[model samples]
Target chain A: MEALFAIAIGTLTSCAVYLLLRARTYPVLLGLTLLSYAVNLFLFASGRLVMASAPLTDQGLERFPDPIPQALVLTAIVIGFGMTALMVVLALRAIHATGGDHVDGGER
Target chain B: MNHLPIVPILLPLIAGSVLLLSTKWSPNARHAFSLAAVVGQLAAASMLFVTVREGPVLVYALGGWAPPFGIVLVVDRLAAALLVLAGIVACASLLYAVARDTETSAQRFLALFQFQLLGIQGAFLTGDLFNLFVFFEVLLIASYALLLHGLTADRVKAALHVVVLNLIGSALFLLGVALIYGVAGTLNFADLARAIPALTSADAPLARTGALLLLVVFALKSALLPLGFWLPRAYGAAAAAVAALFAVLTKVGVYAVLRVYPLAFGPQAGELANVAEAWLLPLALATLAFGALGVLAARSLRIAAGWVVVYSVGSLLVAVALFTEGGYAAAIYYLVHSTLASAALFLVVDLVAGDRTSAGDRLDTADAMPHGALLGSFFFITAAAVAGLPPLSGFVGKVLILDASSGHPAAALIWSSLLGAALVVIVALSRAGSAVFWRTLSPSGGARAPRPSLAALAAPAAILGCIAALVAWGGSATAFAQAVGRDLAKPAVYVDAVLGGGHAQPDDRRRLR
Candidate 1:
């Protein structure tokens, strides 16, 4: 489970980095969304991973599975949703306003 | 009142909501309300400052809940002092807009400006790392809207980059927060401080990763060295008043970096102590050099103002890099001075270019300035203040920073680079001053530039006047800054106020659950 989670995060992060490094706006946005996903997963996995058990500790566990990371990831998701929406509008606005999608608004 | 710590954040939030809801309010009416709200905030911040200066840290847990469970707002000398500064700059920013912009412009500005203020003050006071991230978003989202206000292609382009970059910053911030919480089992600073020392060996690596991630995020936010490419491009394209207000934005990054470095990883950080000291020092010095050279190479005053902000951030990182009492104190003083001076310079840059019909702020010798003498003096005073001229707060602030760096091995490098930055700024400003004002003097012909109304000039003039007063009272302010430094050096005061003994139960996870 840990290896799978690690591989997923690494793959997401690398893809995001590649997309982010692109010269165009949409790719960068896509890259960022992936990056946020990577970060979100990484944050979620920080609670040390739990199986079908509730986020809370069950009948025999010493402590609750740590609801904090769950709460943290939930907040990040909401914020990321707003952030992605804003970026989409901004990229569209940029494209409309500048006639180019290159990150620097295209010197042309 | 007694809820002093939350007022700075709450007032702005309430005022901003009111502004957002009252779509029917006249632009003039909205402007009046916004200005009134900023003044009220100034009053609240001043009250907080006085209370903090005379007493201990003021901790206000939301909903009467306590730290670690309920989010707490911690107002120490550092936060209060920053609040006071933010209040003043905010006032100047709003006033600058109200004075110069039309009613329509004012209508569009109020809610966003207030929201931005809410975020800034929130960042200053928030004791929870997650809360800090939320406030950063609040302020940043407002800044994004404000940045795109005039909607010029250049600004929109710049805003796109800023939004994307900051969005990434947000991701990293969350990433860091999560790792910290996972390792320490809490998101509160006070709790983190306590828990970090006892972290199991296995958690250490994750904690370190979290710390380094946070450092990178802050460095990106503050526009430190290599990560600073987007600043000049974005800030240079922002409106004058917006740019001026943004002087606080970079400082937020500085404040966070300074806070986290010491509290999370400083001496009490136990095994984590001095984890970042190795890289921050050299990077900061290089940032200073980079910013100084950028200032020298800048083509326009507006762009130069952006570089100056970057330069100021560099110097601030120097203070953090020092990681000593004197260093923190010096950073505090420099922080205040740089915010004021940088904001004032950005404003003055606009004023100098306000009346020029062609070559707006290009520092050219072509067109004559409309109010050359008055604007010229504002420019000179602001330039000198920024470059560390005598009898100005910059001079005193730089001396404090240098004094703080006295014993460090990098002292000489910091000094030379600082002095070098100063010299470069002087050259840039002088070249800009002479070309933009002097060379187009009466020797050629009388000035033909249109004069800006007194209203437009008031805010920058008032800001510069404040700098002058600080310069005159330099000694006392320096002393106060030193006191703030000593207070921050001991995080116990902050922790005790927020999560110390009796409040511990209130913050326990069981109660929270």
Candidate 2:
């Protein structure tokens, strides 16, 4: 299951990178969002990919997933949301001002 | 007083919140509040510096949580010194802003500026990798807002490039952290120090790949060579104060590279350590050559600021390449000097621009020496300092770096480049000065004398004073560099502080899980 999740994230990251390399603004923004999601998941999985339960305390349980990475991912998720919002606003403003959404505005 | 370590970050954080809440207030009130906040931050930073200098490395665990689990703020001598510099620059720029009436949307700008300082301070002080990323994002976001404050077409365009490039860097950084955490199972610097040695001995490839990923992220952030193309464009297009503020941004990247690369990978006590330096040295030399050439090729004052970015990359690379205590000291010393000189130069450029009638014609008019003796002298001094002439802070820092790198072949190349670049910079800046401030205009030698306002004069004076102080205290400054170099060389101080001292056995590692 952990391997599957890692593969899935790796695929999404590649897709995001390709889209981000495009010349259009909207697709680049989408790419960033997708890339951010992949990053968040990847960070989460770094704690060794627990499937049965969270890292919360339980009676007689010797081992559990690390909680630090989870906490870090939570923060990243919040910050990532902020970043995406800022990018969207910036993109919309650029589109409104330039009347186009291309990265270099066809300047070649 | 024990809690003072976090105050450098908290003061600005709280002030920004207050500024946001007081959005409907008069701009005067906002500017005053911003000034007060910066002054307070400066005070807090100074106090923290004193504390760190006098005591053991100050560590303030966030929310009272210890390290390796909860977040921690670590204020060693080096971090404290940087905090002090950031506070000073932010305050000086704020003063200039107040005088120029450039404090548009004063509350928002001040809030973001404070947040930017917070982010810088956080990055310097934090002991956790994830926290570093958080601070990087915070600083970058604040920078994006600050860069677009006036929303000129050039600024917007430049800011778009900066944001896109930086976002890619940040993504790479996050991926590096993820990979490192996957293998090491801890994000704290101290824990990583303990965990990495064993991991490298067992699986060198994972460690090497993670280290390389981090290096790329930092190189991009520091504007090294090819990855640095976006910096001059973005930074050169912003307002003077904004550009001056950004002078510290790339240094943060250099600081991270210095801190992480040496501590984590450079001293791994195995074959891994040998391979790490081999990769780092060439990259450093390339950065140095690229930066020197870039500065020579740049045509405008703004473009020159871009060159300074390159110069910093080169200087830092010299230290990393040499990988000696003296080399690291030289790097830290040069870091301090470069930040001050660059900020001073940018402020001077802004002063010149302020007296012009239009942005395009600003450089043209400034060349006419409209500001008279006072402003001209100020400009000459700053330009000289930035160009690294004798007896200035820049010269002192460069000499220390060269001295530190002496006797090594890499040092020889770096020193020659340093001297050659200095000569070229002096020539370029002198020509620029003559063209912009001393040359008589063609057709009619009678151009209107630029009557710069008192505020314009004060701004550069403030920055120059800071530079002068650094130069005058060159002895202590070198001593400080040596101290920081000692600390950096002995990563044990950091590891001990972060991991509560002692090695983590394999059983203990399992217990941590």
Candidate 3:
């Protein structure tokens, strides 16, 4: 199971890096979103995977997943969401103003 | 700890929110309010600095929760120094901005500026790694909007580069935090120091990778050598007032490096001992050389100022790579000097750039100024200070750095590079100065030159005055830096203060299920 998750993360990151180098803004934005997804997953896995148990404070169980990484991932996800939204708006504005979709706004 | 540590973060947060809602405020009223708030911040931070400058670490655990549970803000002399420096720059730039801005929408800009301060101050004070991430986001988000305040095409383009690069860096910061927590089971710096010593090799790769990733994140933020491509363009595009405030922003990255590398992964950190020093030194030296070349190649004064900022970052990191008390003292002194001098440079360039409309910031063109000689002297003094000429704060700071570098194995290389970078700067800036100011000097030469107003001159003059204070009080400031250095060298005080001196670790953390 861990191997599967690792492989997925690796694939996502490789694809993200490849797309990040593209000339257009949309592709780069998509790449950032995908990269963020990978990062979020990595953050989630940092808690060490658990099955069939939640680490509720009321229920003190020996077999419970660490809760901190969940909080961390949730925070990261919210931040990532905001980041994506900002990037999207910035991209659209760049395209509208410069009449170009290239990342460098096509020769200023 | 008193309420002082939290005050630095809270003051700005409150002011920012108030200013954000004050849309009814006239531009003048808004400027007054913003100035009042920054004055409050400076006062609070000054108090904090005085309290911690030569005293014990002040730790404020939010909600009264101890380490590993609640967010912790640990303010030592180092944090106090950065806080005070940031405050000074913020205050000076506020004056700079308020005097020139005529639009009522200045309220929003002021609000954003306050929030930026909040983020920067929080980043400096926070003892928890995850909190640092949150603060980084706050600063970056605020900066993105601030960079686009004027909404020009060039500014927007530059903002895009800065935003995208910083967003990626944020993701990496998250990755690093996650990896660190995965290995250490805690995000608190003190806890990490404790945990790192006790860790057996659980792949060992995880911890090392995490450390390096954190370093990379900081490197990107500091605009370290290869990763610094975004700096010149983004910063050069900013208005001079905004650029002046940004002078301290790069130093925040330097502060983080100084804070993290030594305490969390210092010599005593078993698994991650000396991780960055070996790699950082050579890279920093290379950055200096590269930045010097960039300075020479720059087409515009604004562009050259940006390169000078980069050059100072390189110089600060060179001291950081030394990883000694003397090195850190030198670094801090240089950090303070460079911040004031470079900020003054940006302001000076702005003053100069406005005179040369046809020249349009190019170094080759010389347009006459209304008071070309006075402005010329200002430019010369500011550039000379930046280039480390004698009788300036820059020289004093460089002397300390040179004094600290003598015993290092790469002493000769360091010395030569230090002198060489300064020489290049002197030559380039002098040439640009001569072309822009002296060669073009005339009693009545250019029609487009605006009269040099007192408001226009006030901010840079204030900045130069501060640099002069640094020089006049150079001995005292050096002593303070030495004290800061001693404090940094003994991380035990920090770790203990955070964890409640001599207190054992909190036992709430359990192993992975």
Comparing 1 with 2 on lDDT, the higher-scoring candidate is 1
Candidate 3 residue runs with Cα over 4 Å from true position: A55-60, B101-105, B441-448, B501-508, B511-513
Across residues B374-480, which tens digit of lDDT does each residue of candidate 1 receive? 88888898999888899888888888888989899978888998888888878877888888887763333545565777877889888888888787887788788
State the weakest 10-residue window (summed lDDT) of model 2 chain B.
Answer: B358-367
| Per-residue accuracy of model 3 over B1-513 as CA lDDT, tens digit each | 478788889999999999989988777787888889888988988998888876688889899887767778998999989888888888887887777544313778889999999989999899989998999898888888888788788988898889888988998998988888888788898888777666667735687788889888898988898889889988898877788888888887788789878887888888678788877999899888888878888988999999999999998899989999999999999999899988989888877877676675787645565667788889989998899898989999899989999999999999999999989998889888887876664444446666657876888898889888999998899999999888878888888778875454535465434
Please tell me which predicted candidate would have the highest TM-score against the true structure.
3
User: Share of real contacts kept by model 3?
Assistant: 0.74
TM value for model 1: 0.95
- Native-to-model Cα distance after best TM-score fit, residue B313 in candidate 3, in Å: 0.5
Tell me how large the interface RMSD of candidate 1 is: 2.8
Please report how far candidate 3 places residue B107 from its true position, in Å. 2.4
Model 2: residues with Cα > 4 Å off, grouped in runs: A54-57, A106-108, B103-105, B268-271, B274-276, B358-367, B442-450, B501-506, B511-513
The per-model DockQ list reads: 0.63, 0.64, 0.74
lDDT of 1 by residue, A1-108 (tens): 999999999999999999999869889989999999999898888777767765676666654466777888888889889888988888888888998889888644
CAPRI accuracy category, model 1: medium
Clashes of each: 0, 2, 0
